[model samples]
Target: MLYQSFSGDAEVGTSIFTMNGGSLTAAIGPLFYITNTDSIIELKDADLTAMSGTLLTASADRWGNNGSNGGVVTLKAENETLDGSITCDSISSVTVMLQNSTVLEGSMNAENTAGSMA
Candidate 1:
């Protein structure tokens, strides 16, 4: 499957996107964009290869716009392979956890934030 642009605003306790057990290719745009507090994108047990794009969190105007606090963006994956670039903005709380034989074959760029990759 090929995705051109993936962006949305999800409510709390809800996920914006989720993928499991397949091959996904993203074109020349953002793979995922989280624009609300506690929004999540769960990619578990899948093979995703991105050419050139980002998994950005929040827009410039909406940065830190989640109730005066950074929104929560979670990327949880297990046994997956990701290729290309992913970015998390400064005003968002992003968590990325890849475990159990997962491989990342490109750049993961986070701006003014920290996340776990294990």
Candidate 2:
């Protein structure tokens, strides 16, 4: 993937990664390093009955596409907890919905956007 980044430096791509449970051992580097526009990332809290220690963690930064055009991120957490970070460049969009008294740790950084967790 590193080689592709140096090809043109004009096009920004999108990749999706999802996890349902358990651990991901021996992982190197950031799982999601988004720096593109028109990307979609959805992190919803599913399976609330089990109630494990920690469910998910994420980090993304989409700021390379068109200088300030980031992708879209939809996070829906219901009856669970989520941690990590999400960052968007200028003119990006993100919708975060926490239901059933859910908890979201870590941070979400979005420029020129408004959101509330209640």
Candidate 3:
């Protein structure tokens, strides 16, 4: 299933939509109001559940400066059954490893925080 919209309006089949010299490439579905001054979108392995709106700009890549939002960025699984919770800009670092691993259950609102485990 590519996309089955209830009302949000995205159902793209025979998927090859590209706009070079300005940059846009979509295969699957669901992209609305991508008001691009400079844009890049890539999805390799995806089964992402949900995300609601309100991001009024400033999301530069190269692993730097990930801030400004109205809350909701989620990546559910990485390297098998990874659980979640990551709230940046308030400053947070959480890393969980194998064999019955859990971290930062609740109430860690950071001004400056650091954590390490192996």
Q: Write the per-residue lDDT of candidate 2 for residues 9-47, one digit (tens) a residue.
A: 555455444445443422444333333333434434443
TM-scores across all candidates? Answer: 0.63, 0.44, 0.17
Model 2: clashing residue pairs? none
Query: Candidate 1 versus the native: TM-score?
Result: 0.63
State the local distance difference test value for candidate 3.
0.24
Instruction: Give stretches of model 3 more than 4 Å off.
Output: 1-68, 78-87, 91-118
Q: Cα deviation in Å at residue 84, candidate 2?
A: 2.8
Candidate 1 structure quality by residue, lDDT tens digits, 1-118: 1111224442335456777787776676666555434655668777665555554444333444444444456677788776655555555455677778876665665343433221
Evaluate model 1: give its lDDT: 0.55
Candidate 3 C-alpha lDDT tens digits along 24-116:
223333121121012222232333221222111112222223332111122112222211222222222222232223222222223233221
Top-down TM-score ranking:
1, 2, 3
Q: Candidate 2, residue 60: CA error in Å?
A: 10
